[model samples]
Structure formats: structure tokens, C-alpha cells
Target: MAHPSSSHSRLFRASLLALPLLLGGAAWAQQPPPAASAAAPAADPGRHMLAEIQVIPRPVGTADDRYKHVDAAIAVIQASGLRYEVHGLGTVVEGPPEKIWPLLQAVHEATLQAGAERTLSIIKVSGGAQAGGPRVEDLVRKFRN
Candidate 1:
């Protein structure tokens, strides 16, 4: 029997190992980033009456991609007199449920204006929940003491 060359053995092991690592990396890359916080309780059951908008603009091939999206979104919301916090996946704007509705509508429009043909949103209302009742600002005010 002939012995395998040392170089050939090393090369064979490298080739075998590379496949799983490459495949694993591809799988990880496909997943979306996680949301910053757990879901807030819906104000009403089966209806999350809050704005959860996502702007999925087509890749613009820019060096500063995030800026393009943020700037566009901010411009649209600001023009409509709404304030927002930029979360990693999207922005979050808080207000009374009624006020939130119109603002969310503007978020949809803003995503459209940002050149996203396919924008998505999850609107739900939550109040009187054990996890944490709504009015995040109120909680903050209480914590200040």
C-alpha cells in the first residue's frame, strides 16, 4: 500500500472542513437581526394596536446604506410632525393609540417614499398586561424617583 503524501492529507482535511464552515456562515447570514426588546402587550387581545413598521428598501449599493434609510425615514416623519426613535430593525414612535394610528400611516408612506416597494407593518394594541402595561414614558417617570 502507498502512503498518502503529507501535503495531500492536509489539503484533503482543509477541503472537508471548509464546507461545513461555509455552509454554517451562509445560514447565519440569512437570519434577520433580533428586536431590541420583547413584545409589548397588546392594548386589545388579538389586535396589537401599535406601529411596527419595517422599511425594506432594495439594496442601493451605497457605502453609507443605513444613513440613506434613516435620512429618508426621518424626513418623511418629521414633515408629518411625528417624532421617532431609530431602532436597529426600524423606528419606534410612541403616543396615545389614536395618535399612533396616523403616525403609523405616515410610516407606511415614509417607507414607500424611501423607495421600498414592499414595506411591512405589525399594528397591535396593548394595555392592562402583567408583563408591563403600556405608557412606557410613565414607567420612566416613576423610575426617576
Candidate 2:
């Protein structure tokens, strides 16, 4: 025998509590449809794309005192035929994405083949709207002197 006004207030409070969950569910469900394949690139590549890559390999318990695995990766980069510059931290290569992606993979594999048990690579890509970004030479021009 609850009062009619009291029952209406209880229902209103319950709905207020449920509103957020309902809205959140709707927002989550509104996400764009999935792409046809997982391997698809996120965006279309422009004519010029640049990638800066650094490969570091840990060659467990070696006293050679030289980074042979890193050297192996460098050799792969050199042979990639893409425009590249070797810096103290990483190497920057400018070219089309189609070429740069495989080149990065090859560098990682080459380091492993050179006897590294574990390898870590850092990569940064700039293209599309940033296609006109500075090249490697531009960054190192003042230092070249």
C-alpha cells in the first residue's frame, strides 16, 4: 500500500541510476564497423613517407665488447637502398610505406640471425598530412659542419 507519489519517485530514482549505463552501452555500440582484414593499413600512404627506426639487440652474455648485432642491423639498413641517415640514437629512412615496412622487418630479423636472443626496435612514422615534414638531412645540416 505504498503511496502513488512515493512509487513514482522510486521509479524515477531507479531510472536515473540506470541512465548512465544505458547511455554508455549505446555509445559503445556506436563504434565504426570493423575493417575487412586486420592486416589493412590504418590510412592510405602518401607518396613520401618517413620512418625513423632504432634496433637494439641483447646478445646474452657476450664479452666481444662490440655491438655485432647492431652492426648487422646497420648493414641491412645500408642495403635497403632507401635514403637513410645514421645517427647516434637511431636511423631515419625516408621512402614509401610499402618499402619502409618490410625494411624494418628485415632489420629486426637480420639482428636475430646475427645471434641476438632478444631484440627491441623503436619506430616513428610521419606521412600523409606530415608528408612535408623535415628530412634527415635537414635535422643534421647544422651538425654536418
Candidate 3:
């Protein structure tokens, strides 16, 4: 019988050898996007991306306003002029990558500034490189009743 540690080492070596095969898609991603034809209309920057943001604030402080800290963060999103919808878990905001990326940082920082002892913001952003990703409605329309 081979030693368990030796067997595991051999398995690890095998996995390492397979890394390039597993990461072949990553190499494709690094390649430049195909050039757009002159006749194609450019995608609007304001409608190119969607971001889901969830902020959790600690030491909520009171029963009457348990979401006080969270609400403060939300206020920033509401005023940003970007299209957004607040769901049970998070708020989804839509716009360009340039705006959405920095705005995510603002939302996370807003909770801490709202007197939260600690805070966390989970964000998911979706977009494409050259063409542009789907709209919020395009993604969830079929699922809706």
C-alpha cells in the first residue's frame, strides 16, 4: 500500500499539469475583442452594465429603525441618477462600468460613515468588453409572472 501523503502528492502534481487545460478559456479572455464594423452603432455607456449591491450594517442600534445604517447607504444610490431597483437582498443599479465601479466603493463606505461599528457590502457586476451586457429586464423578464 502506498503512503497516503505520497498518493496525495502525486495527485497534486497531476492537477498542476492539468492547470493550462482548465485555464484555456482564460487565455481566450486575454485576447483582444473582434473589431466592430463601421456600420455598427456604439453601445451607450450609460446602459452598459448592471451591479447588485448589498450592504449589511452592524450594531443596528434600535428596533424602531433597524435599517437606519443601511438606509443611509441606500440614499446615496437613490440619488445617483442611475437606474436601480431594491430587492430583498440587494439593490441592482445599471450604468456604465466607469460609474458603476466607483459607485460600488461609495456604497460600501457609506455604511461605515453612517455610524455602523462595522459594515459589509457584497457587490456583483455584469458587463461585456466591447458589445455590452444584457439589461436588467432582459435578464429577469422571463422569470417574472
Candidate number of the best TM-score = 3
RMSD of each: 12.5, 12.5, 8.3
lDDT of 1 by residue, 28-97 (tens): 6567888766866445433222344555554421365655644565566566544455557766565445
Residue 48 alpha-carbon offset, candidate 3, angstroms:
1.0
User: After superposing candidate 2, which stretches have Cα over 4 Å from the reference?
Assistant: 1-46, 60-62, 129-133, 139-144
**Cα TM-score of candidate 1:** 0.42
What are the runs in model 3 whose C-alpha is more than 4 Å off? 1-47, 61-64
Clashing pairs in 2: none
> Taking the candidates one at a time, how many backbone clashes does each contain?
11, 0, 0
Where does candidate 2 have its weakest 10-residue lDDT segment? 38-47
Q: Estimated TM-score per prediction?
A: 0.42, 0.61, 0.65
Q: What is the lDDT of residue 107 in candidate 2?
A: 88
> lDDT tens string, model 3, 102-131?
789888888888788898788898887765
Error of 1 at 123 (Å): 4.2
lDDT of the candidates, in the order given: 0.56, 0.81, 0.83
Arranged by TM-score, best first: 3, 2, 1
Q: Select the stronger candidate by lDDT from 1 and 2.
A: 2
